[model samples]
Target: MDSNRLVAGITVLARGSQTLGTAPIPNPADRQHPGDGLEGLPQAVPGAVGLCLSGGGSRALSCAMGQLRALRWLGKLDELFVISSVSGGSWANSLFTYLPEHISDDDFLGQPVLDPSQLSLLIGPHRLDHLPPHNLGEVPTRLGLWRDLDAILTLKERHGYANDELWQGLIGEQVFKPYGLWQPDASGHDPRYFTWTRRYLQGQNGILAHNPGLKPGSFLCVERARPFAIFNTALFSNDGPDADLIPFECNFQLGVRHNFPAQPSQQGAIGGGLLDAFAMGGRYLGEANGGGWVSSGRPARPFALNDIAGCSSAAFAQMLEEQYPVLSGLVPRYPYWPVAERAEQDTLHYRFADGGSLENLGLNALLARGLRRLIVCVNTDQAISRDPASGDIVLSDDLPPLFGLQPFQPGLGYLPYSAQQPGQGAARLYRHNQVFARQAFAQLQAGLFAARQAGGAILFRQRLPVLANDWFDVPAQDSVELLWVYNDFVSSWWKALPFDVRAALELESGGNFPRYNTFTQLELSATLVNALAHLSCWCLASDSTLGNQGGLSNAQMLTSMFD
Candidate 1:
């Protein structure tokens, strides 16, 4: 830091402030002022205040408004000063409409805006000649320090007084030099490395500032004595007789949105030129979610799940083979063979100890463990299959036992002696099964409530035959109407419950949808995984009420329903 330059600037500013309100007016003939009545009369004791807006630009406007209101309440309106960029069109327009004009252009201003006050406005040019150029050749250099100093000097000449006590006191002192840039440790790398380093530095500074036992910047002194000594002088200064406001608090808000060009690129890249643009300048870079490349002004290459499909399948098989050898033996030779067969055969049954049965069990276990809280309601009954040769559909007792399930039977619908009651037979048995499924479903609903109490995310799946209820039928074999109906019902239930009572619910249908199975299971899984990666715990239900409850919470549920 150049002490002489800063002190000279401060001296001028202090003198200007004192001269503006209290000093005797100088005749227009005595100085360069016009012979108008306004000459030498400080214009209404022009007040000034400094404002710093930082972080997400437009997003942080509300916070800025609050800060402004607080300052007004504190009776600091007389000294209000606002510093913003020329690109801050929105904020500049807003402030100009509300604030009074005090002073104009200053040299340190990054972006200069024209104000109605006609006061001096400081505009800092983007120059980069003073600093040594190393790896920044590819980057466009903006205004350098020399231009910034010039702007500050210009502002002082316009408003500062040469003979004020504040001016003399500030200029007669020494100033400390602060580092222009921070360096990372050799061990640190890009991506999260920069974020961690910034956080560490902020924490260290905070600790020093807050520790009552030690003086300010004590820890900083231990690391860099020269800069610390300069800071100490500024902090403990008594020469000026009054504290001078710090002028260079660089804080501003920035908002950015991905803008893709209309013309599509001829390249075979997944996205377009937009991806390349984001890669170079997007706010979120070098982190886990920072792989989108900008090309032709668009996200040209986004991360895709197919990139890892082969590795994922191989890893999954290896994991299953290692963790559950017995079940692994039953797995088909080809990857995803079980799911493919499940879609093809329309035979929902598996022999008790066969690989097919094991697959189902494994799937159920995965759902139960991977999901926090789950509820399943199943309706099992015999289905008739036609013999083409005989042209007759024969009912068979071939329903498969549900995996991860215990034996259960539906009880009698009514008293056996009732006049409407028929003799105990097959018809009666079927009715009992239907009734049991509904009752079990009701019980599962209660269990969902219990799970939520235990701090678990809730999920529900309903599987019932079409004949069992009018609520669970599809118009076409491949139609998702039934699943949607169930989802809607569950959604309504979730909405009615308190936010803490119901977190999420899922509706699963066991029946096969021929048309919807056009895509291979592997392809579908890949797509599903890609979509699920973006899911967050925050859920927004109807009317945009944000909470942890309602809606489909699982990534699989979204993919299964929308895909």
Candidate 2:
């Protein structure tokens, strides 16, 4: 048979199959191919076609072989394509295990795995806000915007399908439209039920359309390789003008409603009181938002061990002298002020009034860990220092400095690219930093193990340094140098410390970090968890720390150390 003629015929059959109602054909034994007259039907259909049968489950592979058989009988056996909805589970199991190992290039039933991009086109566009019922006519209309299977096949013929690019594109698209209707529950709050129902029907349809005289085993191959497509049509709206355009990306208004019994006002209050009584006994402080005593009370004190002033060099030295009287003489010997002077010249600020210091912020702690990993980052300042001699203020570089300094690990530094260049390295570091920050935040919310172990404490502080004069020279006097040292102490400490340290200290001493005046206990807890997870990973990987001498893959390390 001419290959083009065969392909055209197969397309017609496939299109017709799609038009069939959701149910599978009632009688598998009664189906007949168009070109196959009674004698032709038996001969044209491959014997192996009968092997591909849908059993109880609704899966694409169960009926793939049957479709192939039908296509072959129509003389369209050039190429058989299979696309996966997900990378794992039954879908992957069937495809990798059951499909024929090899098929002739010219065969009409050759199986090929489809890239996600191709699958996206096949599934069509999905809008969640206004979901249409699953009627046959509507299915095609919903899928109309997508590149048709025919067009995709043509692209495949020309460019050859590559899974990576297709999958990446699909992932990127989802990043933009997280709640697209194609996702489970795109329409219904519990959409998986509907998805499963649809899959079941499709699988049955394949079995009914199966050819007779094929081995039952062949059905398994079909079931594993047949491509199943789904369309997503979910939509979400935000009232805020500055709300993120990315769907489902923000947590501002997303929620799942629950079904529960309700009682009349007085009765309900009493019932609630009873529940609250039990909760108090069990230490289940009701919902965080509930009008319980814990929820209604003012936020708990911030967690901290040292006075905020202790973060400064002068305070640190004074505290050290007070705690270890013998060290009082040594405090004047070390030039902590030079470091502080550098910091002051660098426009870093020093705080002394309320007890806030850089050493306790959670963001700084995570950054410190990242620095240990040899990852470069830039710190931005909103203001610039004026040059005294030039009588003009100099704007810093547009891009932040690309530098990484390991605080705990003495000297591990890298400058793969110049800070002035702002090239690929800068871009890469920028993206890496952003992703790391976001992941850190997410890890905190998820309450990773390290976080839980730390007793839930975290802190963050912003420093805005404005240089008053261009020629701010390092002072010779020790007191002036001490001021600079204090500034340096805050900046360096802020970058490398983890929030859990403060939380742990707070638990031990019942004290709060002076700087974090408004932070609540819950907020601190969340931050601590995130910081601890990051720090745990850093410690595990550090040669100086645990001393575990195995080089595990990044994913494995993250899972074992943080998960």
Candidate 3:
């Protein structure tokens, strides 16, 4: 290993946490690279905390907020070193970090993430008037017989938005720009892309000097080593073995990531890019499509947060499949994505799918980064499909059973409730999503079992490990440990809405009207209380110490919900 080079690199980083892109890959000869090597940083220490959130549209976002609130209430927000999110969870993460400068920190921090008033404001008279003829953003129109349906769809489109405008609407204009969110008009023309994530991690100190009165990033409800956003895109057919997981991790610039899982038998190399070999803990700091700040050839340019947002949105490909056949469908405005890498033409011709398509929850890539406590928050019931008769919602997009997650930790499946067959749901769309996830998981397990039975266990590079590695799992209970806090839910957020309100959401608009699926803050908190109660067993204080203590004791929460 290039110990001298590695030490020198780390020393430079110690002096300047912002010199991430400047660090060179350590020892390409030995293939020793950096993962949690951002050592010296509080969160970079191995066996710290990892908070992972799943994608389930707005419902999941609200639930994540509830959990964040509880963590903040416990004064344990900064105990975390890393936090990862995908899809709807990503949406909430954005709101937490990228709120407009016009909104005071008190206004943002005091209120919960999903303000009921925010929903009201969106539905107010001004919302419809804002929709341009070319840009139809939720202007509810009525069809004769389909008036109710139109209302629901308009409501759905109103809430279920995935566009560049989302960055503006969610955080207000100018938050993601480098000129600063406060400087909305400082520059003559606004630069759409931002890579300033590294600056925020410095607290109230150095590179990111802020007002003495303003709180640093550390004081936020959720804090971490670095916040990572995951994005998934399909590779060419010949790229690698066809698999669900094509793992990639990024902040402003890319971090340690891979297009395939690490193969245990092959100790020499790791996986990244299109079937390329990177180090076990490699980090690509360059504009390359994958690999770190090393090597030659044309590098892929770094894309802005909006591109990452598009990649994280499951709604993108799902809507495409439903609206038009996959063979000919075009993701609106995606081709003209301002920050996308230039291709054959002035447009990007490739399609990007949901991260959930790889793993229903993100953090598949994050596991290798010395994670100790992995708190997985899931929103099982997204507004996937409608129930024609009762106007109920169906959330059946189950994730594949996790690979090699806590291998020694006995459970029916790696994740919660993954081993069992799902119960029935009446008349719904996307019910098949769960079926596909389960089927894929079963096939993967069967392959592993067969390999184990034959000779040596063949760990597929495209799947999660069947055994934990030094790179990912931490030592717990005399082995590499991962404290798993599992909660897969259809958030109470939707159910909390009035029954009539829900009915209205599902109502079908006859003529070109849209249907809406929405949720509230009440459901997230209700679900969070129970989940937080479940956290008591993690060496936290007893139920009595809980601000919102429940009837159950920590002992009662010992059993895995998956069991």
Candidate 4:
């Protein structure tokens, strides 16, 4: 588990040979394609910065949009080496990464794309190509209700469908449809089937090729600086030995198809580690063939962004069958050939559920890569307390510890540490919880419940403890600085909003403006979405003091933390 051994696309056997269960003979020419693994992206460094986006359906999506825009405005977006997202946060990640080359910040966050008071401009008849209307005229801005129903029917007919697929389809049509990309289809008009293909990245005249600025190159290359994406999901098995190995009988896994480092046989083996992100799905075979492990899979439809999104957000897919039975396709499953011993036997199918089911914050992926500087944006309604008189969801003075509180909450702070002071089991940094002192936290808490709250976003900075186990190999840094970003409606920006605009938002949310309502609220009104987004943006970008405890804004603190 040495840190140096975690290089991308490398195998324990030799230069090229990779195996699932047993060591295979070395072979140099085993790559599936020229740039099969991590070639399209830069390698992650020990101290690189990573951003984690949490899971909260549409709430996370809107908050992430605002946060990302604010990050871009603060000139920190280009500095991010990795962005790990789960559930709704994955929606924003996919959209942000696939943006057309010409769309600038102004074009992205301006009037046409987002209008705070009006309905969502991204939906309905409005095309995302509005800034200068791109040549992708065939792509519709949004697939209307009936179109989606028809698409679902088609999908159900082809193969049994599920709730996750329906959710992913709607997300694609709404957010990513603007990019105008699709998997090659025979009918050529099936809007539900868009794809994230290698053709879009490395083709002679690919999307990235057409715009050299966004091309994959050196991480230091400012022209191509984009955060490597890691979307997380829980690999589930109700009855298997693997179930015992993982907590809740589910493993916290990532859908990072490229650049994932392979482990030695001492560690749990990953046959062939991970294939190309675009090479997933379809039929495949792995046989001895009297040679090293050789894999054979037909060029069937590969897993797209939507597929990953569906899997990552399938958190409630299993439990909500009684509510939406028609949409409950079998628990999201993926086929694997390496697990099968014989070629005649069927491929082993593994079930996948929501990443949040195992780790809601999406921090595992960044930590797995050994990144030491992290920003975790938690846009969840799960931690709220209700008011007795009103019975409405309200911000509680006692905020449950989201990260870094051991015995009380039992997370990162509770993990056994490898590095510690001579006589101490853990460093003071590892044991510490709140970023603010007791008095300061009390003051901040009071302000949160006051008639006029401070701001909608809250920030907590903690040093994440390095686990003693082999799962992480963060040798360069002793501890990680995790900036916790919470979604709360206590911002000065919220107080300053026009009365009419504020009222409309409150009405949409039934008076508890930023309750972020139910996690199942996948669809939201334009007003509520914009209000939350505006509040989120202001929390990061506004120059005003936050929490009534710190004179600096969240953006300023973020810059100084990285510096």
Candidate 5:
């Protein structure tokens, strides 16, 4: 099908819109549609820069708040183009953006408020006047756990007493609203989706008709500069020990293009990214390939907002697979049953989980938003270490693909991208993978094996995902320079936290949280302050022009770091 006659929300937003009130900055092609939907990655709008927050439970978000305060102090708050996150980090980003006037920079800079144990996060000592119920449980009773578990497994129908209601009500309504993040609707069937994502743009309300004035969160918006949030979920399972975990992109700005055609999904008739407007319109769609509308023959149901979070978080599936002995008996299959994947099956679990479970950070997607300079705030502690026997200093894998490089490699010292072309060398840059050519890679590989045998940092490291270095710098740019910031404090704090919180705080990928881990606001504030201090140092070192410079413009810093 031609691109025009496709799904509603699936149409690309790189195009201009009424809400944006500006023409789109044209592109040779959309990275999403590169040579028919499957080639190069998503392309960023020119000069667009995005921030990616790593998942480390609530402390991570609190820490992010601290960093935001620092950026504001550095006179660089509005300079950010996008901010993406997963899990608690999402909670942090959402709260930070939605809050209104009178929010002091010091509110974030001050000491984090906490109780004695440093176990539960507190609300006061900052702008927050009270603590929202971060989680809800009437206490799974000796009388109710099994029955409720069964009811949950049943379609069991949705948001029943079993699950959805508690989270949407207690979590989003209770915790987030007082903080100014989410706004709910009374008339709508799903309150979680009733929120109006406040994009600086004048976005249309896709759900206004059903629950007048209420709208589905915008999948994409353009009016104001905002960070795109990301959540990770297991899309496909290996049927055994592994899962195909992927990131889900979130933007509350809903864009509806006039006279625009939608695309066909290779699989379902109701392709993904369907908006509430079409679903609520009661329009009978012709067929699956034509658009995202439901079949005329069968009713098209409104997709739940939780589907957004559910698919983005695969915690339930992990519980079943891992079957931790303590909670194994409570694992129910009936009401919330994982039915066969066949169409005939009544329903299926979306299996959503944290993005960090897939990649330690959602930096991969951030690269797609058009950033010449990429900065990642990591939780790994210490970039340098001393060898116990020799006293020679060694570097940790705080930053892979970059730190994986060691002295004495096969291709020789300098990484020359245009070695084949003479004067072209000036235009070429260092290759991300080739920087650790064959010999260097083998040496790193050997060292990893030795460490595994000795039970060092990582007993076994998964094969690293390929970096999209080629995508970030843009066509005219020479090289993608990376600034690695390590926070040693998180290691101690994370290691000190309880096993459940540790599971939730996983810096690298792990299972999901049946319920999120606990973290003190004070701890989050302190950790964030430390991270921001590190970030401030880096910015000051780079002359606070890190975002403005890239490629050859950053040659000096690149040369020092790479060498």
Candidate 6:
């Protein structure tokens, strides 16, 4: 382990922060400022487009995939400044960011020849017998998925590990396979050879080789061809506010340079800082000659792509005891110097699970960035209820389960539900959206609402919150344009489908069109999977709300953010 080199890099960062007179947390008020490590990269501006993909197991993965297709069709994927994601949604985000250049171009729908530019062809009436292939290059057969599992088991047998490691191996093969990443211990090779480095995954000459203008001989240059990514994960700390609610310590596997302030009111609290994507798993040396800095300790192995994905999707981690425990994790944390530095002087081992353990929508990070234009794709659902009269599965008007914040959250206010489902009438949905929009406006009517109402802030101690106080030069409520896309069988999309196709889908889904079980239903039929993806795409492409009025489509509303 090259401790000297490791210390030198961290020393430079520490000295620079000291020179700046404070610990580094990206100041939320300064929208134009580029972060420390991201000096040369393109930083998102106030009105820049931000896409948030929420967590909900495999359902989120499929739904996000479809939304990506819609964005690709609109040619807006490249226009996005940030793509914040959590849990199963992170699975899709990881795949999108790391997919081989050729595979990524087609939106993982496996149909490139068919031009997606035309909305008619993209989501038009199609025969039930012939469904668009929604393959994201997953292992073709069950045996192949198990092959990596066997290899991981062998790797585990040779070297002691935990359930998180096993889960990472499985995801590497099943979720991110056939991309040349599944290089397990073959022919007695060193097990470290099996793990993938950040450079090898997205460096200039790596899988992101298709990205043009890549810095020559660079390993950490921001890959701008794709949206800057934040793979949000849960920080398992019982000390945080409302531990039962899983007050997430805002930690992320960031593709771009960013900082997370500890407190909502304090912009530069220095609570957290970026851990170089390459040095994420390295040991901390707080008691060293200088100050706290990362050290490449004995057996210095950098974090693998599988490790990041595993940590982000470790929803099982919430369950402390399991046949194979998943809650355990190891990720480097930047110690807040001088103030909180003493507590973190020694080596720190923080556990991270699914980002949904606290916030599910992935909106908090976007709001903290002060992005005015936001598109959030939500995939979570409440338990499906049965009708009292017919005793049939009720398939209408399932409101978005926004982490129990249906009507509103104090500082963040409320974003009207944009898209309508199979059951909601257009007029009824519009009225509901109008009411929420008015309520949000009412909360923000007073200019000093945030300063006066201390409890109004979106109080999650670990990361920055959407403070009720006016944090922006622009009115907090007036400047923001949020498009919330929940997973639902859109009424228009469903109606567009031919009668025969609808019947076939109803029979296949057993009357439940797109509201399939999340964690409970992992392996879904291809038809059901395509249906879910289709619903998500339509939801984003067609929905409207109070802010996005004048009959302007939701697609245009999202596109305007780029404009």
- The most accurate candidate by TM-score is 4
For model 2, how does the per-residue alpha-carbon lDDT over 1-563 read when each residue is reduced to its tens digit?
Answer: 21111000000011101111222222222333211111100111111111111111111111232233333333322221111111111121122222333422223222221111111111233111111222111111111113322332333344443321122122212211122222312221111111111123133222212222222321111222232221100011122221111100000001001111122311110100111100111212112312211211111111010111011112222233455543332121100011111112211111121001111111121121111111101111112233455433222122121112111111312222334532342132221111121122222222222222222211111112221110111011111000000000122222334344444434622343212211112112222222221222222222221111134322222223111
Each candidate structure's TM-score, on Cα atoms with residue i matched to residue i, is 0.15, 0.15, 0.46, 0.65, 0.49, 0.63
Query: Whose TM-score is higher: candidate 4's or candidate 5's?
Result: 4
Instruction: Highest lDDT: give the candidate number.
Output: 4
Between candidates 4 and 5, the one scoring higher on lDDT is 4
Q: How does each model score on lDDT?
A: 0.19, 0.19, 0.32, 0.46, 0.32, 0.45
Task: List all candidate RMSDs to the true structure.
Answer: 32.7, 31.5, 14.9, 11.0, 13.5, 11.5
Q: Model 1 compared with the native: what TM-score?
A: 0.15
Residue-level lDDT tens digits of model 1 in 1-563: 21111000000111112221112222212323221122111221112212322211111122223232322333332232222211111122123221112321121111211111221112222221111211111111211223323422442354342211111111111000111111212321011101011122233222212223323321111111000000000000011222211111001100011111111220111111011111211121111211221011111121111111111112222233355443243111111101111122221111011111111111121111111111111111222233455443222111121211122223422222222652233222222112122233334334333333333223333333221111101011111111110111123223443332222111111122101111112111211111111111111111221212344433233223222
Across residues 20-129, which tens digit of lDDT does each residue of candidate 6 receive?
Answer: 11133232233332233221223346457788888776677777867887787777776677788887787777766655544444536533212112223223443222
TM-score of candidate 2 against the unseen true structure: 0.15
Residue 524 lDDT, candidate 6, scale 0-100: 56
Enumerate residue pairs that collide in model 4: 20-271, 162-329, 163-327, 454-491, 454-492, 455-490, 455-491, 455-492, 456-490, 456-491
lDDT of 5 by residue, 29-128 (tens): 2212111221111234654445555555443454455455445544444555456665445555555554443443344233322211233222323322
lDDT preference between candidates 1 and 6, better one: 6
| Candidate 5: C-alpha lDDT | 0.32
Candidate 4: tens digits of C-alpha lDDT, residues 416-451: 222352113212222322222232333323443432
Which residue ranges in model 3 land beyond 4 Å of their true spot?
A: 1-44, 100-106, 109-192, 196-245, 259-302, 324-350, 382-400, 403-563
Worst 10 residues of 6 by lDDT: 455-464
Which runs of model 4 end up more than 4 angstroms from their true locations?
Answer: 1-42, 102-105, 110-151, 157-175, 187-224, 239-272, 282-294, 316-320, 337-346, 383-456, 469-477, 518-520, 548-550
